[model samples]
Target: MSDIIRRDPRAEWIARNRLHPLHAAMQPVQHSWMGPNGVIRKNVHGVGFIGPNGIKRIDRSGAQQGGAAKRTAAVEVQLPLHQVAAPAFYINVVPDMVGGRLSSHDRDLLGLARQLAGSDGAVLAVVFGEHKENAFATAGVDRLLVLDGHEFDGYSPEQRVQGLRAVDNQFNPRHWLLPDSRSGGGELGRRFAASLKERPATRVWQIKGDECIGRAGAGQEDLARPLPRLILAAVECADPVSETRHEVLPLELSTALARSLPRIEDLGAVAVDPAAIPMAEAEFIFSGGNGVKDWALFHQTAASLGATEGASRVAVDDGFMARDRQVGASGTWVTARVYVAVGISGAIQHLQGIGACDKVVAINLDPGCDMIKRADLSVIGESAAILQALIVAVEAYRNGAKRDAA
Candidate 1:
């Protein structure tokens, strides 16, 4: 009887444990377009199978649509602990065009949100507007909560605050972020924080876990340690203040404070490293703006003075120069020793970025332009003519200095 038909438990287990492959043998593939032979070519897009017989033709109806890469799974990223539980951030949507499309601050805010939202943590963005879509919808946000209300379209700060508050209540987001600008944003943030008693970090460059870090600090040394989440409603600075008022301080005032107060170790506020702040040690700066009609002459003047060229957002947006070199709400903040504003209108957005300069010279034909009021020295003349003349004067001054040294 075949050795009494002894059964091996191990062999039985192996046969029982054999796994059926958990996937379809032949996934549907599709045709795709490829560029070849200097022309778009159509070809089979993915891998498939031939029958076991290897000769019989079958229907190609199983192929899925939309090229070759079949959608298999949802994409997701694990965020830090605080980000997971922290209140989602609501980016109060700014208009794409303001002041007749002359202002680019809205676009700048959108860009800043894209940069800040993901860098610090996985904070979701809640966009509010008539369109009510993420200005950064392309950033692969997990969830975009669009709150569309007519009040937002009307530009009512109170309405905006109320709408935002309602959304916040529903979501119970723990943190709020906004840009530092004169466009009622500061007031809105302040009011919202007051109403909800939740922490608001305005003009926030970076958000760390649940803690928001900034240059703004309460003056008391001990108070500086805990670092309260407050409105950084102005550009960032690393200086001590005689008085810490929540009110926004002009860039010049903050710089003066820095000079007056001695730097203390572990002051809590992020200090402005001179190296990081542009043009802080510059002897001369040639600034240009939309008023400077001739790009070639602007370049020539900068070259003549051996000065770095600065352009306002107007010039940059109009395709006259790159954004990095642009000076305005969306551009680099600077504290140059000497600043020359050529044809710039000195809008509040522009002023916020360069108000720390020691000396400002304005060159423009429009005496009424706001830049004239802000400049320590105002020259009322055409930019081209004034720039050409100034370039010669600077060159002569340099040559005279060399001769005197000799």
Candidate 2:
């Protein structure tokens, strides 16, 4: 028995940490279910279990357990007061050029900052472009710093970083927050974090008390922690109620700061198809998976429904779709009102990307697939047959509505 015992390299490390062998070896398993014709099919992780009827069910226990552990650890781990540089929270607010107003997302950030500040700490709102002071003041900001000029007119990542740097130099704020807008705030916050040699939390959709939760780098795992040095938050669509008034502090634009930053000539904006809206902003999405047969029909149906087109990582990897349209952990994160998954068997990474979506509708051949189990509505059938039927139904509905109006 002693001669047959296998030597584990991690045994010494596990013993030193006082961890059980089972705990060290407990890795998440990729679960599969019986598909049509008795074929076994693998779905996303954390969504597979054996049912009493011999059919497999989605088991989210692994994800739930991991999340619970992380949250518990976050709550229990208390950093010393000496480690904290300051108690205040800083927020970067970018103006909405198209809307010609302060982005409401800024208000959400302000709300988060206020919550983090509590009674003792302060919340500072940094603004770019020409905006009325009252706009931010009414959003519960404690203080406002304005940086307005021609250089700051359009979205310039460099100028934003420099402006943020100036504020950091003056205030040395410990906590920084920015809206996770792709074209604006997201880029600014990520660049700012890189400049400071600090890791930034990006696309964060939820904040619980003092803790911030979001996807870790590479979209591998859910990360939750107390306020960090910097955060790029994905502001929810709903408006936050404001209670605190703010004091506006207008600052003169520093010509030296502008000149020091590399000035790149603004070429006219590149024209893109209006239909190809960023997945982040799309309220309705039609996503395709490996099982989709007619790519042309998929695009046509999505266009007909006025929905943004998206794809699974497998489809993108197989060159069936563009990488930008890939919706998964390693790809882009989408927070759509309605997400339609056609032929997609949900993977854990893909599920994480669309976790915040209001409703999910999955159409797959396999009834026991992960997407079918997790989706709000599931249609089990062949992709081509369902795609054509859905298109015809949409067209008929439109025609009927038109006749009724007439």
Candidate 3:
């Protein structure tokens, strides 16, 4: 018994006492090993794995310790209020494409204005058509300046720029926020910025406190600064719970301002493509790439899904799709809710265009493609086969929904 228990004296003594039947019967069954310090030692170590000893201590130099303390102190310091600039006036040029009613994109612009106004400034919206005062009031705007009349119904780049210039002269706004949507807002903003001799930042996406951050020019670098002399923003979504709200003061359009506008010949309404939907307005987009073999089936799938058709640059260059349908860095940038890339290898330029998309679905032959890696859901198979199955599934679901509704 002594040879079996060479280490612990308590274990040897216990074994010696256990020789008697009474002592062995009286002893309680013990499985745990406790230290002499009246505590159970845990197997914890600095390297994450348990070693022979308990824990290993890592030593840090005095300089490293002091640096960490300094970083913590720096974070606790309060930022100066003067760092943020509060503009005297914020002018929002409402696009003419939405007519009298405010779209989701328009509401987003109003939300941004409310955010920028804070407590010191006023947000003035320049609307193109006649709308109910209550409609504009609920948008959290300080004032609504209407540009009514038949002449303002259609969008003309030259005329719209003149109208914006007239508004700028009247108000003398230090900051201008225009929608960068395809609804002629982008064109109007560029022309207006040129007329004012100010470089406008287009497709602005994020607003951090008082600093506006967005992509500048063709490069990918994100630029940040306080509201410049002119700013062109693209509205991604509407915020329902905005803090700023004010009674909207409706202002009548000046007769002189309207009459002073140049008269351009109305080139009667041009034919619109019935099959195509504008990329900016599309909530769902089905984009095809070079891997797509069946263009006819692609259009059918888009129609079934109630999605707008878009194409990669390669597809456009190959004459498989039209120029206007191209979606990339050089082409149109789309901010759709759901973008389905069928047979499209995600080029960097194509990825840039759809950066604002909420969800992306990629169907491709190669599992390691960039589109597959970036997509929220990836279907690995032939494009035509996958799309056909998806179309059938969608049609069946719609039929079932209709029957249930009935």
Q: Count the backbone clashes (under 3 Å) in each candidate.
A: 2, 3, 0
Taking all chains together, each candidate's TM-score versus the true structure is 0.34, 0.44, 0.46
* Clashing residue pairs in candidate 2 (N, C-alpha, C atoms within 3 angstroms): 47-58, 47-59, 48-59
Residue 161, candidate 3: how far off, in angstroms?
Answer: 2.3
Better of 1 and 3 by TM-score: 3
> By descending TM-score, how would the candidates be arranged?
3, 2, 1
The positional error of residue 23 in candidate 2, measured at the CA in angstroms, is 60
Report, for every candidate in turn, its global Cα lDDT versus the true structure. 0.50, 0.67, 0.66
Show the lowest summed lDDT stretch of 10 residues, model 2.
76-85
Q: Write the per-residue lDDT of candidate 2 for residues 1-406, one digit (tens) a residue.
A: 4678677777555543413533323433546533211224343223454432245454333444555334224432221121113434444344332234444456556666666666656666676776643555555555556776677766577877888787788776767887777546777778888999998777675677667778666656668887577888765522342333454444443444544555666676785563668887786899999989899999989877878899999999999998999997678877676899998878778886776565799999876566875798998898888888988999999999999999
What lDDT is obtained when candidate 2 is compared to the true structure? 0.67
Model 3: lDDT equals 0.66
On the 0 to 100 scale, the lDDT of residue 284 in model 2 is: 82
So what's the TM-score on candidate 1?
A: 0.34
